[model samples]
Target: MTVIRINAITVPADSGDELAHRFAARAGAVDGADGFEGFELLKPTDGRDQWLVVTRWRDDAAFQAWLDSPAFAHGHRSESERGGGEAQRPVSSHSEVWSYEIAGGSPA
Candidate 1:
């Protein structure tokens, strides 16, 4: 079954743009991964600080494989970890991953 992972990143009121910019910088990084289906970055429109990163995979195994891969680590590394002079501050203050599957839904 298809699996969905929603990374809810809560940033400060003024840091939404930076979060989106960072995601844009690494666009398509996961496109070639095995069983990777699609992704979306959702910005809040109701004065909320939480942004949503939604990714779809063919199954849990596929998602877990990506999580254990080098690409995942590289994509999530801080600037200092990637050999930059200094570590850039994180945009989100808090975040959590929510998992789900197609319980019931109409066809896309």
Candidate 2:
């Protein structure tokens, strides 16, 4: 079954774009991971401070593999080493992850 993993992160107002830029810089870093399907970064424009990282995978196991991949390690290492937003910026630390297994949906 296909799965959708949404990593919703909260950053301070005016800092969403900064976090977005950082994500863009690392785009495709996980493209080679097994069963990696797709990814997207979302920003809210409703006077809110929520940014979302959306990823689709073949299944839960595939997503779990990504969480364990070396690429994941490198991503974290880069964040700390570069003092990125998650480090240097005053973004809020609140975040949430939600997962769903697709039951039925129209193709996009």
Best by TM-score: 1
Give per-residue CA lDDT, model 2, range 1-108, as digits (tens). 779999889898867767877787777888898998899888887877778888899988999998988788777454556565445544657989999778887999
TM-score of each: 0.92, 0.84
All models: lDDT?
0.91, 0.80
C-alpha lDDT (0 to 100) for residue 24 of candidate 1: 81
Candidate 1 residue 94 Cα shift, in angstroms, is 0.6
